[model samples]
Target: MSNELPTVALVRLLEGARYEVMPTASVVDAVGEHVPPSVTVTVTAAPGKGLEATLSTATTLARAGWPVVPHLAARMLTGRGELQEVVARLAEAGVTAAFVPGGDADPPAGDYDCALDLLRDLATMEHPFTQVGITGYPESHPTIDDDVTVQAMWDKRAYATHIVSNMTFDAEHLGTWCERVRRRRVELPLLVGVPGPVERTKLLGMATKIGVGESLRFLRKQKSVFARIAAPGFSSDRFVSRVAALSANPALGIAGLHVFTFNQVGVVETWRQGMLARAREERVHPTGRGGHQDG
Candidate 1:
């Protein structure tokens, strides 16, 4: 049995598949411990807060020699001139990509109501980013109608380089959504969202502090049926495996995993390394010549 891990193969998988590995300022040190310098880490500004905070996080991380992508939430910018300043700061820090979500910011700061609107504004900017990622909902959004969500994606397609799915736990639903995106002619590569390797207790703590429980409620309400999230743990292993399986399917066009590290960077990195090791070993084992050993 060949238990050797293929470094090149895994590197390609990581590079091709991953969208954003989110790391918060509170856990910036943890990011240094876990995330490889090769992967881009996206630092998020608290929604509705000004771009200064997000830019600061991105600047710090970029200075640390890590490729950093800042989330430029829609409601954060004051105007076109403010947008230019934000872009200039990001460019100065060597950030080539950013994630723009219709921020939860109430009453909006400027003209943009949603991500699509922000994308429109960004397209007109002189310093347009080479790579811009937009949110995709495999599950229905809490407040938005399904038809509207679909239409919004179509509208943003020209501005977006990739689609990063919002966090959804159901793999079957995710697979189906990938098909839907393809059917709708959404050719942008997808980064399947998965919760990271945080234990249930700790995740609950962070979720409460970060208002994630409310977000989870929003997701559950959008789902066809409510699910009691399986007990005592959060792991991206199954989520990553489901995504890797989809890589064999030519039609879905799954690009990679976007781990919602939720500030649990160290544990998530450990989980990824372990799975990649197992996957590599399984691929080489003589006993399982044609079978997926990881399964």
Candidate 2:
């Protein structure tokens, strides 16, 4: 809670943060123009755009010399054959990491029902991705129970390298969730997800375009986040600082950040740079604040 702790944590997180963007038409260009090769770029897979779009964007980014991590939605793949093809393509593109989510597809598109199922299948493949990330929900899921989500992470531990937590504005909840994950013995490091500096209207529009289910899920489960985003002069600076403070406890295994850019790569990159600069500045000249400081 000391000023030094959060200032240092914020610098660490910002230095190694990864940007997650939807596979929209302008996303590749946005990332190429705004993001550097140092920051990893993650592409999302949505039912509306299909898995192909996700792969295409990832491959393109990889080819452009960026570290790319693609989301392979379990429900999007037909079976192992399709999964194999997907892996082969990523391998060809030199992508070494991936994130697998159960996906929002209703009645699932194939053999795998959950992320665990796809992860299990991936384990059988020869030389699959070196790093696999699974979703973690800090807040209650719209459909799944809170306990079930934690258990799901436990069940997928063998197959996943880390956990990318779902975005939440509640820093308290996020900190508690990290403690809960540690308590359950899910030792995989966590990449806390947070929204980038995106406009509320733009974010909402993109969410709606992705899928009605996803939009509904966001509206229903992230009401607080929505309210925060809609507020005038909304910024993630304070939220990220609070989340970063958790890193002071090594037991939490707060790896870094996973920024949901919502395809607003330019603004997000600028915001990140500004935050990192401020954190570095604070680290050098201690403000002497005893407790945590909110943005």
Candidate 3:
């Protein structure tokens, strides 16, 4: 494929991208101030604040006219009753999408142990959500093996509408993982997870406090990931351009980007706008070089 194909694809992907924010105190205001209502915002569930934080933030965003998708952590709920209530709450708030992940809570807070368990129950209920997403790992999960993660996706395929890959910096790993998913026949469309223009110090601090086992462990294990983020001239624009070519393959099922903003909503939004503007310019002008200049 010519260089323009990926640049064109990057433009389309950025245009439809969604932002993921933690359920922080200032998140709603920050998102409201920076992100336009046209963009979809997803609220993350954390063990420290519990599910309520995610739901409340999501409801607030929804009421304010931004499309919202709340993460429903399986291990956070006590049982079916709690799940029902949560679903009812989201329905009342007009939330149309949900992303289910096996939570970080050690010892399992309730009857659910993994996302598939919660997804199974969700399938049985007349839930209000029109779209449901499950996690996909481009790199090996900190705990689960590659085969196990792939099998988990296959098992949950009946319930999930799409797959949101975990944050990854390696474009080669991402491309290989996409091929693996297709070879295994887990056909759900993917929203590639990419970190926004987050500050390294802030991101590390928040990750520690949030206590997400997978994220923290992944960070600890991959020292190079930290190095890259902490590197002087780091910009997600370069990473996105490297992987943007994969989206051109229909068989890969690359839907769009799911940007992990880490509550840096304003900065992330600025970066998104800059990238969109640049990608569009490249598309229109036909620079002939596949890659975009780092900002």
Q: TM-score for each prediction?
A: 0.84, 0.92, 0.92
**Candidate 1 on 91-112: residue-level lDDT in tens?**
8877888888886666678877
| 1-295 per-residue lDDT for model 2 (tens digits) | 2233777888889999999988878888888799999999999887767889999999999999999999999998999999998999899889999999999888799899999999998999964588999999986777899989989999999998999988877788788889888999999989999988788787778777666876776566566766777677555888888778777778788888999888888999998998888788788887798433444
Candidates 1 and 2 compared: the better one by lDDT is 2
Candidate 3: give the clashing pairs.
none
- The segments of candidate 2 whose C-alpha lies over 4 angstroms from its true place after superposition are 1-4, 208-224, 232-234, 290-295
User: Candidate 1's C-alpha lDDT?
Assistant: 0.67
Give model 1's TM-score versus the native structure: 0.84
Ranking by lDDT: 3, 2, 1
lDDT of 3 by residue, 109-197 (tens): 89999999999999999889889999999967777898899999999998989999988888888988999999989999999999887
